[model samples]
Target: MSALGLKIIDESVQQANIWINEVDYRVGLVNKQRAYRLLRAVLHALRDQLTPDTAAHLSAQLPIFVRGIFYEGYNPSSMPAAIRDKDDFIARVVAIFGPEPPEDITGAIGGVFDVLDARLSPGEMAQLRGQMARDIRALFAD
Candidate 1:
């Protein structure tokens, strides 16, 4: 048993770490913090673009800890934000980093998307893609 005496929490932590590590690997980032930033930014951008119901559905598939990250600062009322194109979606993710953003933000975000694709169910991935604009959908392309 973990120090917290909760197997679920331990599993969630492990899963979250695996996710972050995969993102770092895929993005070629040496810094886990940068990987985390990219992951959080990409998740928020995608979450905001999904309807509240769809967002919740996606969240349900996430590890407990990652689910928290997915919902951080989420305002469902403003959801499915009119991010109709890739530029708009990328802009939103970049906005979170302020100035002096990462060198390859798009690639990094794509890494996060890749992690999502590898982890989530194919049906869920398809639903998530269906919610996105064409340009944004290209990021998830194999």
Candidate 2:
């Protein structure tokens, strides 16, 4: 994984945890485990889909975006309250890939997610986790 991708995943995990806590506290809904699983799924998918060159480029740029976010004096703890939906959070993750990823990569990503979503229930985030693991292993076996 690119360093920036890694950092984005790490930051995203932290942000997700904060969101989960807020949801639990405010709405009595706790799904930290599921959230973590989803994050892992997405990160794995991203890593698998990107070429080494793309990954390296993204890794280099991610810190600058992250630093900008920090420079705005944004508190990580407040992320949960600010991000009210999963899609919005995902948009941020997608933004790290730049506005236009290569067409082949974009198609592959769509395929991966489509297969994953079809094979697993949205509530069963872990299902995709295993699939992602299997896919990664298969890719490396080539």
Candidate 3:
């Protein structure tokens, strides 16, 4: 289970890294509209890889990212609470990906989660990290 979890995490990280690189490259060359479109495309691609339940949850959350990219001078605080939303996202990912996450990728999964959680408040972020760790342990228990 640990091995599988690692694999899933690794694959997710690789995909995310590639997506970020692509977004950076596109942002350098495109207008705001085009850059946002590229970000949407990346989100869509990532969404496709998620389980239906996880995808639905994330789909609802994705508008946050879109608004950040498209709206001028948008404050993150003005948007809906990311801390609350991110907990759900992390939970969904753990639930959906736990059963069949690839082997040898646990570190990658941990890394991606670490990076995503960095945006949260310290207390809320620690709670999410603890939840993820617990979830991983639960996955390996059986």
Candidate 4:
């Protein structure tokens, strides 16, 4: 049990750590904080590109803490943004970096997608991928 005596909070933190670690490994980054920032940036970019209901469905499968991160500063009313093609999507992720962007932006995005693929169900992943353009969908591929 955690200090707060909440098993759910403890478990959610554990799960979030597992995800951030996986992202770090996938992105080949030693710094977990960088992995976390990369994860958050990609998630926000992806969420803005998804339909509100689709975004909700995807969020349901996320760890409680990660889901909170995913939805941070989200505005559903203006969502499913006009992000077309891979370049545009990558631009959105890069825009979140605010200077000092990752060396391999596509790899960073794909690293987060890989973590999502490993954590989320195939059905939900398919639904999420269906919302993206074909070029962007390539990042989710094995």
Which is better, 1 or 2, measured by TM-score? 1
Per-candidate TM equals: 0.94, 0.26, 0.28, 0.95
Tens-digit lDDT string for candidate 4 (31-89): 88888888898999999998899999999999999999999999999988999999999
Error of 1 at 17 (Å): 0.8
How much is the lDDT of residue 104 in candidate 3? 25
Candidate with the greatest TM-score versus the true structure: 4
Model 2: lDDT to the true structure: 0.38
Per-residue alpha-carbon lDDT of model 3 for 20-115, expressed as tens digits? 444444335223333333444333323433344444444343234342332323233333322233334344444444443323233333443343
List the global CA lDDT of all models: 0.88, 0.38, 0.38, 0.89
lDDT of model number 1? 0.88
Q: Which residue pairs show collisions in model 2?
A: 4-59
Deviation (Å) of 42 in candidate 2: 1.3
Worst 10 residues of 3 by lDDT: 133-142
lDDT, candidate 2, at 136? 35
Off by over 4 Å in 1: none
Which stretches of model 4 miss by more than 4 angstroms? Answer: none
- Could you tally the backbone clashes for each prediction? 0, 1, 7, 0
For candidate 2, lDDT tens digit of each residue in 1-142? 6556786677765654553343233322244443333333334334334344433433343334322332232333432223223343344435543544323433333433443344334543342233333533332211
lDDT of 1 by residue, 1-142 (tens): 6968998988899999999899889989878887888888889889988999999999999999999999999999987788979999889999875665578777877888999999999999999988888889888847
